[model samples]
Target: MKTRKKILVACGTAIATSTVVARKIEEELEKRGIAVETTQCKASEVPSKAEGHDLIVATTFVSGAGDIPVIQTVSFLTGVGIEADIDRIISYIEGA
Candidate 1:
């Protein structure tokens, strides 16, 4: 496994929503024994901020993620499909 996986968590404002998402992702990844480094950003900034990151998890739609995998979800806020999202994240990390 990679030493650390870099993740970009994006939301409409990059503050409240992204922070929650980032925290959840960090906890989930850590439970799987994967070290994670996360950066929070606005959805509009994803194109630039997503560079060099392993994955993008956003509550809002993100465009121009380039080659990085983007998992668009509101599960972090709604408490639904959170497990599926985590599974997808793990898949991306393992595959990478």
Candidate 2:
């Protein structure tokens, strides 16, 4: 069996916005048969909370994520270019 992917979903507040992004990522990836675990954090917390995660998805600028792949976008909130973003994330999973 394949291991579940760990995704760190971050935004400015780490509350409402991050929740939305995390939930959407979980829902979308599950439909594609990809198991994922998402943890929400503030962008400022990213450097400290980013370890052990496979990927970082943020709605704002984030750094200190080390070598983990980071996808910075507002697509989830905007409802635009979402498919392309998801595809990009899927590509990372495939490569992993």
Candidate 3:
């Protein structure tokens, strides 16, 4: 396994929503003994910013992630199905 995974967390803007999602991803993954480094970016920036990242978690729609995996969901903010999403995120990272 990689020592640390890179996750791109994006929302409508680069600030508020991404912060919340990034923190949630980090915390949940840490609890599972997975370490992650997160970058917060605007949804519009995903295509340009996704190259180096292991996974992309977006609160809004995003395309152009290429070979990297992308999970677009708002469950982190809505507090619904977040556990499943975390597991999904882990699967992608572990597979990578």
Q: Which candidate tops TM-score?
A: 2
lDDT of 2 by residue, 20-88 (tens): 999988888889888888999999999999999889999999999999999999999999988999998
Flag regions of model 1 displaced more than 4 Å. Answer: none
TM-score of each: 0.93, 0.96, 0.94
CA lDDT of every candidate: 0.89, 0.92, 0.91
Model 2 C-alpha lDDT versus the unseen true structure: 0.92
Q: What is the lDDT of residue 61 in candidate 2?
A: 98
Candidate 3 lDDT by residue in tens digits, 1-96: 546889999899888999999998889888988889999999889889999998999999988888888899999999999999998998999888
Tens digits of lDDT, candidate 1, 28-95? 77887877899999999988888899889989888999999999999988999988999999899778
Between candidates 1 and 2, the one scoring higher on TM-score is 2
In model 3, which residue pairs have backbone atoms overlapping below 3 Å?
none
Model 2 stretches astray by more than 4 angstroms: none
Of the two candidates 1 and 2, the one with more favorable lDDT, higher being better, is 2
